[model samples]
Target: MSLAQGRSYLAIPGPSVVPDAVLRAMHRASPNIYEGELVEMTAGIIPDLRAVARTQHHVAIYMGNGHAAWEAALSNVISAGDHVLVPSTGRFCVGWGEMATGLGAEVELMEFGTKTPMDADAIETRLRADKEHRIKAVLAVHVDTSTSIKNNIAEVRAALDGAGHPALLMVDCIASLGCDRFEMDAWGVDIMVTASQKGLMVTPGLGFVFFNDRADAVRAKMTRVSRYWNWTPRANPEKLFEYFGGTAPTHMLYGLRAALDMIHAEGLEAVWARHETLARAYWAACEAWGQGGPLTLNVADRAHRSHAVTALRLGAPHGTGLRRWTEHQAGMTLGIGLGMSEEGDPNGDGFFRIGHMGHVNAHMVLGTIATMQAGFDALGLPYGAGALDAATKVISGKA
Candidate 1:
């Protein structure tokens, strides 16, 4: 029998469970787009948005998703023939590099496998070798959503400085913005890009790009800056309608306002802490389940694991079956293992991901782990017992 519930849990990596407060805020009748309370209300969001990013830079709002933010960030600071050193931790980094390539920039990629974090020393070595400093920027993903690996942005900044490289340090924070601890200005990030869906707890469609003065300087020099992607008008809009270079994404703004309020109420620090705590608990649960089984964490080191998501390898076909059983029988949705399987292991037959970011609490996390454990048993997958007990102890502060 399934757990016929009042609400279906959307536990995938993104488009997370939106708060009712945010939904209610967005459900109202459409407000005037050109000049109205929505405009005035949105003006108030910049400071708070900067606060969440821990940035003192200028922020540009876009009427698109994370991919758009990536393009916007690239468009503002780079031109054709510009070289960007992309240190990819997973698929998203490669995606960002692809964007740069499409935009006529020369892309140099540094892959750290699917499960490993970017090696700062390796990055430093590469930068030092580029004596001409042709690498105009280093695009780093703060948390790679596909592989569930969190790179140390600050360390990458330090590596750049230590090597005396003048590359702009751009970060993709789409998956980690509100869930992980990120200090944009302090970390020397020239540009930070994110979307509303993941950790910000809002629906998709809105993307944000935060740029420091250094990036602004670069923007000023770009003779070919696309008017639509230009940050100047969006950042200091005299009329709110110009914020999007057109009609604003009104409902998304309302949802974002509510989501930001929820984040601030809990406090960014506390939010990060909660995610970290829950992530640890989930890891503990996974460790217990894999004790005598084929399941194992994709990333070997716990320190490199992402607070927003966890990637697991459950040994071949069983992994796919387990996820299907959980969703079909237990009514739990698990994230598909992205970028972890090669041609031989296609269909993500041996991998799965657990999304523990945004609008998730202890009970929701516990229930997810419990259901996954049930899936293992139902599928007759090899595993040890006591997974739930271990997870509960972590949540309850008993272990």
Candidate 2:
């Protein structure tokens, strides 16, 4: 008998579990769009948003998702013939490169296998070879959601510094924003892109682009930016319409404000610590289960994996089977192994991810782990015993 009914849990990588406070905030009737509290709230949240990004940079709020933020970041800084170096760890980085290509930019892709982090040495070597500084930007993701690999943004900055290259460093923080520790100003990230979901603990539909003055200067010089995509008016808007492209993302504003309040109340550093602890608990549980089984952590090294998401693989049908059992039988949803199979591996259905990002606590994480073990049992798959014990120890500070 399946117990899939009741309060369901979503353990997917993004559009993470929304807080009730945020939901309540968004549940209000339609606010005045043109001029009112929505406008003030939109303008007021910039500094707090920048604080979350760990940057005092200028921010442009886009009424779309992470993909829209990607487009907005690229649109403002790059011209048609610009060259971008993409250190692709997973599908999202490759997808970003594809966006640049669509924008008439020549993309020089530095392929790092799905599991490996970007190679700093290779990046330095490539940049060193660009004597003409033909590469206008280096587009990278802080954590590739598809593969669960976290690249070192500071190391990328160091590589650029070592090469003395003038290319802009544009980093994607879509998956890592609030869950991972990122220092935009300290790490020298020129431009950072993210959305409202994931670590921010808000529903999808709002995207954010944060950029330093250097990125602004690039925008100032670029004449090809579309009117809607340009950052000047968005950054230094004379009215509310300019803050957003047109009418504001009214509900998202309220939701984001509530989420940010939650984040700040707990403190950003503390939030990061909570994510790390919960992620460790999940990892310990997964590791134990993988013993003498088809399951394995896609990212073996603890140092490289994302705090917000963990990618795992099982042989062939088991991976798909486990996901199905957990969702259909256990009332919990796990993220599909995106970009980990087919081109990355022979079996496309052998991968899945757990998203334990924002608003997740020990109980929620432990419940998910327990459900996964139940899933294995339901599928008649042999997994290592004491997985729950291991997970509990981590959560309780015993492991």
Q: Per-model C-alpha lDDT, please?
A: 0.90, 0.91
Error of 1 at 44 (Å): 0.6
lDDT of 1: 0.90
Q: What C-alpha lDDT does candidate 2 achieve relative to the native structure?
A: 0.91
Choose the strongest candidate by lDDT: 2
Model 2, position 258, has a per-residue lDDT of 93
Displacement of residue 135 (Cα, Å) in model 2 is 0.3
- Cα lDDT for residue 306, candidate 1: 91
User: Which pairs of residues collide in candidate 1?
Assistant: none
* Estimated TM-score for each candidate: 0.98, 0.98
Q: How many collisions between residues are there in candidate 2?
A: 0
lDDT per residue (tens digit) for residues 1-399 in model 1: 676355668788897889899999999988999777998889989999999999877999999999999999999989999999999989999999999999999999998889789999999999999999999999999999989999999999999999999999999999999998999988899899999999999988999999988889888898888989998999988998778999888898999999999999999999999999899899988998789888898888988999998889997787788878878787788888887786678778888888888999999999898888888888888887788889888888887
Give the per-residue lDDT of model 2 (tens digit) for 1-399.
879999999999998999999999999899988777888888779989999999887999898899999999999998898999999999999999999999999999999998889999899999999999999999989999999999999999999999999999999999999999999999999999999999998999988899999999988898778988887898898888898878888888999999999999999999999999999999988889888577899888999999999999886677788899999888999998888775545656888999989989999999999888888887888888778899899989898
After TM-score superposition, the amount by which residue 370's alpha carbon in candidate 1 deviates from its true location, in angstroms, is: 0.9
